[model samples]
Target: MNKNKNQYINREISWLSFNERVLQETADVNVPLIERMRFLGIFSNNLDEFFKVRYATVKRIVDAGKTGKSVLGGEKAKDILEEITTIVIKQQSKSLEILGAIEKELETENIFIIDENEVTDTQAVFLKSYFMQKVSPGLLTIILNDLREFPLLKDTAAYLAVKMVLINEVDGNENKENKYALIEIPKDIDRFVVLPNEGDKNYIILLDDLIRYSLRHIFTMFTFESISAHMIKITRDAELDMDNDLSKSFIEKISSSVEHRKISDPVRFVYDKNIADDTLSFLMDKMGIEETDSKIPGGKYHNRRDYMKFPSLGRKDLMYSKIDPLPVKDFSFEGSILEQIAQKDYLQYTPYHSFSYITKFLREAALDPQVRTIKLTVYRLASNSQVASSLINAAKNGKQVTVQIELQARFDEQANIEYAEQMQAEGVKLIFGVPGLKVHSKICVIEREENDKIKRYGFISTGNFNESTAKIYTDYTLFTAYSPLLKELNKVFDFFETTYKINKYKHLVVSPHYTKNVFIGLIDQEIKNAREGKDAFIKIKMNSFTSYKMVDKLYEASNAGVKIQLIVRGICCLVPGVKGMSENIEAISVVDKFLEHTRVFIFGNNGNSKVYISSADWMTRNLDFRVEVGCPIYDEDIKQELVDTFEISWNDNVKARMFSEQQDNAYRKNDKPKLRSQFAVYEYYQKKLNA
Candidate 1:
C-alpha cells in the first residue's frame, strides 16, 4: 500500500460491491419475480462493462509493468485484478442461486422455461419449424478441425463450442475421436423464443437451446457418433485506440477504431461449467487464454444479459405497476415550455414527470420561425432519437443548428457516429467535441427573435437529452430562461469550437478545469463554518464518488466537525463514519426500480441551502478529462425540491444500503415507514401535481 491510504476504498472493488447491492435486489423477496430476474441481467450487464473499461485499464497497467498503486488506491494492478476475479466468482455463484430461486418462483406462476431436452413432442415440432424458418439461414457454423487458425471471437457475443467423435476411415482405421466446431449466435434474433401460450401457462426456450435442438439439421454433412454444444463467450477489451494519422478524419478514425474493437485482447472468456474437458482445453489452447486472463466457468448460458429483454407475457402481476408520469404542477404543455421558463425556473424530475416536455421544448424551437439558432451538447442519445430529429428539423428549416455529439461515449459510439453523419448531411453543424475532452454536458440553448431582439430559452439536464432513457433513469433537468446562465451555456458551445481558449464560468461549474476546484471551495466553506461554530452540512447524491482528492477534502471537512451525507448509487470510495477521519460523514446507496442517475449537491451555508444538479460523478475521468456541467439551483423552490428528494432517498429503508469499511453492502433498515424512495418520489410528484 502507498502513502498509508486508510479512508478511501478502491473504486473498482467499491464498484463490484455496489453491483452486489444490485444483486441484493435479485434476492429481495419484496421485489417481483420477473423484475428480480431482470435485476440479475442488470448485474451481469454492469459487470461486462466494468471488465471492458475498468478491468482492461488495470490490465494495461499490469502489461506496462507498473505497480500503479498510487492511481489504483494503494493496490497493485495485478493484485486488484486477482481480487476482482475472486469476488466476481463468488458473486456469480450467488447470482446463479438467485436465478434458480427465481425460476422456481416463476414455475409457480405457470411460466415454464423449457430446455431442449425438456421440450414436448408438439413443442419440438413447432421449434423445428421455427428454426428452419427463422434461425437456419442466419446461423454461421465453422468447422474448426480443418481450419488453419481459430476465428477471432466477437467481443461479447455468445457461441457454442461443439465436440464430435467422428468416424474416420483412413487406411481402414476405425475412428478418430475429437472434432470441434463453433457456432456464432445471431445478434438479430431474439434470445428468448416464446412458444404458443397453453391456456394460462407460458412456455419459452432459450435461443441456445433452440440451436442445440437443431444441431443435427445444421450439420447434416458430417457423420458423428455424438455431438454436444455448450455456450462460450469472449469479452474483449473495448478501449478505443485512435491512431494519429492526420490523413484520416475524426469519423474515419472512430469508425476504424470501432472495427478494431471486434478483435481486441480478450479480457474474459466464460464457458459452460459442464463443457467437455477436452473441448474446453482445445478452445483455450486455440485462443491462447492464460491464468492472468479471467476464465470463468459459468452456467448453461453465457450472455445472461438477454434476461433484460425477457418477455413480459402479459403478467402485470409479476411486474411493478406502471405509474403515469405527472405534469409539472405549474408548468402546462398548453403553452410553450419556453414561455413558462421565462416566467420562473421549473425543474423536471424524470420518470416522475413526463419527458415529453423536453421534446416539446425542442419541437417548439424547431418549428418557431423566430428561433434563429439552436445549440446543444449530447453524450448519449436513444435509438430513433427524436432529439436528433428535432435538430435535423431545425437545420432543414434554415436555423443555424450546432451540436456537440460525443463519439466516445463507450458502447454508444457507433450510434452517435451514425447520428452525427445524419445530422451533418441535414446541414446541422456537427461538432465531434473538444479535441481531448468529451463534451458530456447535457445542455441545450436556443435563441429566438422575440420583439426584434434575441432572447434565449434553454434547459440543463443531469441526464441525457435522450427521451427513452428519461423514462427509466432518475434525473433532474432545469428549464429556465435565465439569460446569464444561457450566455454561459453559449460559452460551453463556444469552448467546443475553440479548444485553445479556456472560458471562465461563474454560475455553471464546468469540468476539465473548474468543477473540482469549485467543489473543493464549497467544502472549504463548510469547514470554515464548522470551525466558527456555525451550522454546516454538505449533502450529495451521485452515481459514484471515487476521486481520492475529493475524498481527502471531505475527510478534512469531516474531521473539522462538518456534517456530511452522501446518497451514492454506486462506487463510493470514501469510507464514512471513521472515528477521527470521517465520523461526521455518512453514506448510503439506494438501488431500486428506477436507476438513481442524478447528481445533486447541497451545502448548508449558515441556514440557507445551496443546491446544484450535475452531469458528472466525482470520478477522476469525469472531473479531469470530461466536459461536465454542474448547474446551481438559483430558484428557491427547486432547491427545496432537490433537498426534499434527497431526504427521501437518504431515509430509504427498503432499498438503501450503508457504506462502511465492511463493504458488505448491508441494507440500511429502520423502524420508520417503509420509504421506498423510487416509489415515494413518484407519489411525491403525483401529490404535487394534484395539489
Candidate 2:
C-alpha cells in the first residue's frame, strides 16, 4: 500500500490549488471583464498572504533545521518550501498571461490602459498636474550613494528602484557610476489614474507608469543619461511575536508586534523581470536576501492587487450587476425585531437577505428601555462598524454592555484594538480574550425585562459581525428566541471571563472542549445507522478541512457504507473518491463571485437529518485552539433551509469544481439545467420573499 496514494494532501499545496481556482476566474470568459481583472487582484492578494503566513511557516521549519514531516503532513520542510516556490512561480506566470489577454479585451471595449510612453499630449498635461498636486509631496525618495544605512522599506508599500546612469565622465569610466535611488509609492494616492475620456474611449494609467512619466520631476538634482524605474515589492513575515512580559498588557504586546512587522525578515521579494540585472542584484545584496527566500521575477506591475480598486469607468456592462439585499420574509423594521424573534426563528443569510436585521437588532437593544444588558463576542468588525456603535450606545443608555473582543484576529488586530479602546472609553466593559484561546465564535445575546421576567434574544452567526464583508461574503446568522440556546450562548460569554469554568453545552458544539468529540460522535451515529441497514449520509460545507483525525473518522464512516459529501471552499486535504479509502465520499469546491463562507453540516440520522451551522471549520486550529461555536439548528424550518442551500450548492454544474485526486479544478458538468449556486441562492431567497 502506497502511503501517499490515498492519504491527506498537503495543506499548503491544497491552498495553492484553491488559489489557482481563484486565478481560473481571471481567465474564465463567463466572468465580467472588469470583475476578471479584479479576480487577478484577489489572486495576487491571496498569494501575498500565503507567502507571509504559510510559506513563512515552512521556511521557519527549515531554518530551525528540522524535517517537520510530522507537522507538515509527510513532506520535508525544505521540499515543501521548494514546491511552494515552483507552484507560485508557475501560477504567477499564468496570471500575467491572463492579465495580458484581459488588457486586449479591454481595448476592444474602448478602455485603454496606456503606459507612460503612450500618454497623449493632453493626458501629459493632466498627468503632470496630478503628480505635482497629489503624488510628489508625501513621496519618500532615498539616494543610495551617500546614505550609510539603507532606509527600512515598508512591508505594505511598494518601491520604485531607480537606476540613473551618470553619462558625464568622472574619475570613473562611462556608465560606471550609476546612482541608485528608491522612491516609495505614496499609499494615500490611488493606483489607477483615470485619464480624461477621449471621445467614447476610456483611458487609464497605472500609478507606476505615471511616476515613470514624471521620474525627472522626482529626481531633478541628478546628472543623468537615460534613467529607468522598475517596480519592486517585498513581503515580510507578518507573524506576531508576543514576548512573555507579565507586566505588559496584551494590547501593548500586540501593538509592539505590529510595529515590529515593518522591519521583519523578508519572506518574498517580487521584482520586475524586465529590470536591469544590476538593479536586482543591488536590491538583493542591500536587502540581505538569502537563497531560501523566494525571489520571484514578475511582470512590470508588482502589486497588481491595486487592480482590485480598478476604476469602474461607469461601464456597468463590464462589471457585475449589483443586487439589493432583500428584506427577510415575515420580518419588518416597524416593531421590535425581538418581538418577531419571539414569534419564531428567522435566519439572516447576508448579502442575500439584508444585514440590516443585525444592526436593527442591536439598535433596538441600545434604545429599548426593557433591555437591561447586552453581551457579544466580536472577532472582526467593519472599518466603520455600526455594530460597535450600537454596543457603545447601549452602554451610554445605562445598560451593562459587555464585549468579549478577540484581540488576536489576524490582520485585524490593530482595528480590533482601536475599537476595544473606544468602546471601553464609552463605558462598555471589554474582555480581551480567553487565557490561551482566540474567541472565534460569532454570538450576541441580550437580556430584556419582559413581563417582570428576564427573556433573552440573540443571534449566532457563521461569519463576523462586520457589515463590510456582509456585502459579499455568504454567511448565516440565526435569530432565535430559544432560551436554552441563548442560555448556552451566555455561558460562552461567561467562559470568556472565567476560563477555568468548563460549562457543558447541550445546544452548541464549542471548540477546545466539545467540538471534536461531538462531531466524531455524530459521525459514529451515521456509521452505525449505515451498518444497521438504514439510509445514512453526511453533508458538510466549510472553508477548510485539514484535521487528520476528522478525515480518518470520515474514512471509517465511508468504509461502513455511509455516503459523505463535502463542499469545502478553500483548503481540503481529504482525498475523496479513492477505491477503499473514501470511495463513498465526494467533494467539490465553489469559487464564484460571492465567497462560499457558510459552514453547514448535515447528517442523515436514520430518516431525519441533523443540521448544524458553525463558525468553525474542521481544521485543527478551529476545533482545538480557537473558541469556535457550532450551533445545532433546533428550528426545523431553518434546518431545512440550510440543508436546501447546501444541496443547491452541491448540485451546481456551473462555477462548481470537482475535488479529485488529480486536483485539476475541473468544473462539474451535467445535462441538467445550468445553475450557478451563488445566483441560485439569491433566487432562492427571492422566492421566499415572493411566497
For all candidates in order, the CA lDDT equals: 0.91, 0.92
lDDT of 1 by residue, 546-649 (tens): 99999999989988889999999999999988887888999999998999999999999889888999999999989999999999999888988999999989
Scanning candidate 1 in windows of ten residues, the lowest lDDT window is 1-10
Q: Tell me each candidate's TM-score.
A: 0.98, 0.98
lDDT of 2 by residue, 14-86 (tens): 9999999999999999999999999999999999899888998888888899999997787899998889889
Pick by lDDT: which candidate is best? 2
Task: Kindly state the number of residue pairs that clash in model 1.
Answer: 0
Report the C-alpha displacement of residue 38, candidate 2, in angstroms: 0.7
* Candidate 2 backbone collisions, by pair: none
lDDT of 1: 0.91
